[model samples]
Target: MESPTEKRPARRKDAEENRARIVAAARAVYASAGFDAPFDAIARHAGVGRATLYRNFPDRYALGAAIVEDDLCELEALAHEHGDRPDAFMKLLSAIVERHTETHALVPALLRGPGEHALQALVPRVTRLLTVPLQRARAAGLVRDDLTLADVIDVLAMLSAVLADDGSGRARDRRMARALELLIHGLVPRAPVGSPIGPNSPRM
Candidate 1:
């Protein structure tokens, strides 16, 4: 009748470090090889044994959840960091786009898989975190009058459509940069040209 936590011993520092490494490696592997990548592959990438990986994560869904949890914590920090700023919304959106470009929209895709209810729970938390920055953007006229939280969520959904890297790193980066720039211009009152984004831009 004992729970898993009750049965488990205190985690050693090295065990904790290995778990962190596995999760980080899982994220990287998923970005490059898709989420369904083999556990052995993940273990190899982490430089840990398959047994070590399994000890930490029971399955891919668990790994997905861990990645989502990490992302949520990061997002919460970003929202707090941009407190009361008018362009907080834009900055947050840009940061998200950059992350998606790197991770290939894993967070969005994670919502519909196994343990989805727990992942779906993220929606409200994400919404609540974004509410204040969105209000600031609206109040300061940094974004358009019609911009709504729903629109913001929709934008994330759109960005999440990208679930895997196509191995065309340069082309993929250009395409995503174009998409982010377009999304920003659509949300903002004015769109700038030659400000450094999209294809032909040296810096991302």
Candidate 2:
């Protein structure tokens, strides 16, 4: 009974909602099975036919792009939330490691190249959030003076690779924490060992 113009908008809204649902279902499937997840399974989960799924996503790369966009948005929120703290660099690094461990599938796929442009677009915003805290940490002799923003990005990528290996999560996290501690220690200027100040203190 409605006019075609009014009905067109309603239909478009419905299509958008369906596409969102399909993307969500695809994300869940990928998280469980990575890139090997089948289109049929995703279609079943989305409650759509294979044809409908293809209509929405077109191919694996399209689905991957949608998921990566969601992930980058989440990462951006986290970066904003913790990027200004005195220990922002450490917190930011830890958060990245945790995500690498938990969200194993999405990271590598995004790192492959499809999401690089999106990440590049986000870099200025992310760098603005990180720069002052990182500079302060360097000034405090708490982070490496020679470290560039790109070095921090490389460290994150390496940590993600480490997490992707076939190790237990608990062991991997413990090792990553130790490695980060060592990296931090290496960055700082060490003072000579002073005399013990308390009974509980180790003998110098």
Candidate 3:
């Protein structure tokens, strides 16, 4: 009989490959069709059987979480590596915004589903990734000191609307790029004025 230890490696390899395949297919399908894309469709797209997809990701949220976790990991690594650069925050934010454009609408909805716990756990990690570079940018005077992590997240959430699957990809990209530039500009510290005319402050 073959040794169990020898059998284990092959099994593990196949499992890892299947997981990668599922994630890739899920990314593409979710990008075009949103998170409501059928699980069976994703399994077929990955060229894996339904049982394999289930074995890897038990539900839609599980599948979505996998894609998100992978993206966050990459973003965190990029932020850590470029934390000291003056433009690091902008660079990282730009990359994240661009990537999110692909699946912006779907992510929020997926996280609100029954299996959201998996994604909820990842929120803090994504926050951590953004924090270091944001703080660094503030210290370097590239971003306003008043800016907070929540503000950054809120901006990203709002920007997601710009990338809604309307018109052509080129049109969407052009609009999104311009919107991102405007958002980045907002982060720059401005000379304070005595008047309280800012957004919600009311005119008096």
Each candidate: RMSD to true structure?
6.4, 5.0, 6.1
Kindly report which residue stretches of model 1 are placed more than 4 angstroms away from their true locations once superposed: 1-12, 105-112, 161-167, 190-204
Q: Candidate 2 regions off by >4 Å?
A: 1-20, 107-129, 136-142, 167-204
TM-scores, all candidates, are 0.78, 0.64, 0.84
Kindly list the per-residue Cα lDDT of model 2 for residues 1-204, writing each as its tens digit.
788987998889978887888888887787677776898889998888888889888777677767656655666677678655656666666665665565666656755856656555656766765677678677766666787777777776666666676465578768767766666554444544794546685321
lDDT of 3: 0.81
lDDT of each: 0.77, 0.69, 0.81
RMSD of 1: 6.4
As a whole number from 0 to 100, the lDDT of residue 26 in candidate 2 is 81
Pairs in clash, predicted candidate 2: none
Against the true structure, whose lDDT is highest?
Answer: 3
TM-score of 3: 0.84
Question: 148, model 3: CA deviation in Å?
Answer: 1.5
Question: Tens digits of per-residue lDDT for model 1 on 41-90?
Answer: 99998999988888888888888888777777887898888787787888
Candidate 3: worst-modelled 10 consecutive residues by lDDT: 195-204
lDDT of 1: 0.77
Q: Model 3 Cα displacement at 113 (Å)?
A: 1.5
